[model samples]
Target: MKILLIEDEKDLAKSIQDYLKTNDFVCEWVTDFSLALEKIALYDYDCILLDLMLPRGNGFDILSHLKKLNKSDGVIIISAKQNLETRLEGFNLGADDYLVKPFHLSELLVRIQALIRRKKFDGNNIITFNEIQIDLLSKVVKVHGISIDVTKKEIDLLLFLIGNNKKVLSKEAIAEHLSGDMADMIDNHDFVYAHIKNIKKKLKNAESKSYIKTVYGLGYKWEDE
Candidate 1:
């Protein structure tokens, strides 16, 4: 999943980024409110970790901006402000969850998963479409009750495709989702094609239908046949 972390503490932000990365989350981080505002305005994220104390502006303003744009990105207030007023203000501004600072990274990870599940999957950890079953927590894929040997990236791709269903996803979008902050450094989207090819081959071997369809001159879509 894609996560935007708006934090001012450089060390804390890096630690959070590194911890989330190890759990297969694409995290883009900004240390100031200006950059955070720019990112939230320009792109979409599965979840945002917002700190109330920021350099240029308060994180509550970011929440107001998201509300103004009608963006539904799940937000968790990771702030040092533990007062009732601040918490209430955050919730009133549409924050999904709250996490006080000096918190455990593992707890934060689970919170993000819970928020995403509630937002995207109706609080279900298992995603099933036809004969395929994906366990979000275990990162496992099964077809016809048989397990498939797929890499983490393959599972991520599968979820990305299935989550969007019939929508055509551009290579750039997939690349950004996969690479996070390093996406700009990627000169070519060849890795996306490679990952898709690998996922298709593995699914085919498991006797699954060809759900991933390539749109010529465009991108790809996961269609249910």
Candidate 2:
């Protein structure tokens, strides 16, 4: 999943980024409020880790901005300020969860996963589409109760496709989601095709129907038909 960490503390931000990367998250860090605002306006993130006390402004303003834009990206307030008022305000501003500083990185990782689950898969750790079942916690895919061996990237792609369901996802979007920060550096998105092909083969080998559809001159979509 893609994450935006809006934090001013350099050390803390770096630690968070490094830890999240190890967990297969595409993490981007922005120290200042302006840069954070710019990123939130342009890109879509699965979860956002927001620090309340920023360089130029309070993180509450960022929440307000997200509300104004009607962005449904799950937000977690990762602030040092631990008070009833602050926590209530964050929840009032549409934050899904809040975590105080001095917490474990492992906890933060699970929190991000939980928020993304709530947003994308309706609060379920296991995602089901017909005969296919994906265990979010274990990162495993099964077809008709039989386990299918797949890589992490393929599982990520499967979730992306299934989450969007009938919506058409462009190659650029899929590239960005899969490659994270390196997406811009990579010139070709042909890898997306390869991943799709492998996923199709695995599913078909398990006696599952082809649910992934290609839209010529556009992109790909997951359809029941």
Model 1 regions lying over 4 Å from their true place: none
Candidate 1, 1-225: lDDT as tens digits: 899999989999999999999999999999998999899987788899999999989999999999999998999999888999999999999999999989999999999999988987889999998989999999989999998999888888888888789999999888877877687788899999999999899889989999999999899999988
Model 2 ranges off by over 4 Å: none
> RMSD, model 1, all Cα superposed?
1.2
Per-residue lDDT of candidate 2, residues 1-225 (tens digit) = 889999999999999999999898889999989999998987888999999999889899999999999998999999889999999999999999999998999999989998999889999999999999999999989999999999999999999999999999999889888876578788789999999999999999999999999999889999997
**Clashing residue pairs found in predicted model 1:** none
**lDDT of model 1 at position 96:** 96
- At residue 194, give the lDDT of candidate 1: 98
TM-scores of the candidates are 0.95, 0.96
